[model samples]
Target: MSDKKNENGISRREFLTKGALGSFLVAMGGATVGGFALPKPTVSPGPSRRYKLGDPGKFPVGTAMKMDKENIFLFRDVEGFYAITAVCTHLGCIVVRVDDGFACPCHGSRFAPDGHVVEGPAPRGLLWLEVSRTPDGGVMVDADVEVDLGTKLVV
Candidate 1:
């Protein structure tokens, strides 16, 4: 009984084969659905990015300074430090800076000043980017997210 033509129209053997094949395809950058085709990945700026965190003076107290359209918050905490992110866990909707920390304009998800998920829809915190200052006074940051960040990331 490793294989059988089930009443669901998909053979048991075929189901296993497709399941394995689909997983492999998905791992290979091609999502293989049972009845649908895999869409091609568009040419994009490769997954490497390094953004400067600027200076602490750039962002004053209370007000959240906007970085990008998605990254629109940088609250100055008691440590004279700041947080940054553009990812929204709830349906991946980009969060915006509200009177508090950040808010997902799409579905009303909210976050604390420390990137903590203050409201539902978003179940996680923002990314705490490890940054540094270069000799030129401009900051040099390594933002490659797919790799481990607990260790020092060389720019």
Candidate 2:
């Protein structure tokens, strides 16, 4: 056991190891413990759970969809690919998708279709939720990440 006191003479909070563990989470490959805000899906993922919101058909090319319902934004560019995420690089406000791109309603931070920071009170871009197409052809996004700034999804 180890005890390190803070400047207040109170025991400091335990520090969980950080680093590579933040890059990629083993998708549904391990049992997650508690003490997290956005816990696991309340129900088992079924056909309906494939997409957090309604059908992908609702989103067409060049349309930006805000899943504020899920604290995420889904942007469909002319390329037919969509981007999704919640973690804001600024003060962590869930951004809303607008005409050309995304803008944080919190502090007026704007982002492009590819998650590039166009304007700020925000220091950088939002976190990208690595998404894939399910067997049903719906998008599956993972939002368990905590980003300060400069987060991107390569896939």
Candidate 3:
């Protein structure tokens, strides 16, 4: 073949290169525009860390109620209400409530009734979550917020 220039004074190889570059630029521009056009989420996307357990009266004093779905145990004592995570500190396994306290079946980690580490393999004791009373006299627990041990919300 002959190395002849096209009508636009560009050779076949130059034309092909320019075409490829133009296509790439157009594709990138479209992607940018599409990204900008996408709607932004107003709220974060994920499972909520805060749970509202309605009616403080529902949880009577001197009772320990386990919320399996939220992986937390709610306790209401003579003083007030408190929450502790049921997840084992060692391996994130669900701990079963025993007569004495809690036990992890996954790796044999044990916790006391007050969530202090009783057995080995666990780095620390169970987490104590923040418990608060809502404006409507409802109980709310925030799993994401860890409070000091033995902290109770006196409602």
lDDT of 2 by residue, 1-155 (tens): 34676766555334333333443464323434343435756777644323443455666666666666566666665555454575568898877767777778888889886677899877766666645556665656555543333343222
Q: Write the per-residue lDDT of candidate 3 for residues 1-155, one digit (tens) a residue.
A: 34588787888888788899999999999999889877766576899899999998888899798998999999999999999999999989999899999999999999999999999799999999999988888999999999999999997
- What's model 2's TM-score? 0.48
Highest lDDT: which candidate? 3
Name the better of 1 and 3 by lDDT. 3
What candidate 3 gets wrong by more than 4 Å, as runs, is 1-44
- Rank order (by TM-score, best first): 3, 1, 2
Off by over 4 Å in 1: 1-47, 53-63, 69-72, 75-78, 145-155
Which scores higher on lDDT, 1 or 2? 2
TM-score of each: 0.51, 0.48, 0.70
Off by over 4 Å in 2: 1-58, 98-100, 145-155
Q: What local lDDT does model 3 show for residue 54?
A: 94
lDDT of 1 by residue, 1-155 (tens): 75666788788789988999998878766433533453434565575566665554564555446566335334454444334665676777777767777778787788875677888777677666655566666444444442221332222
Q: Which candidate, 2 or 3, has the higher lDDT?
A: 3
Candidate 2, position 30, lDDT: 40
Q: Can you rank all candidates by lDDT, best first?
A: 3, 2, 1
Total clashing pairs in model 2: 0
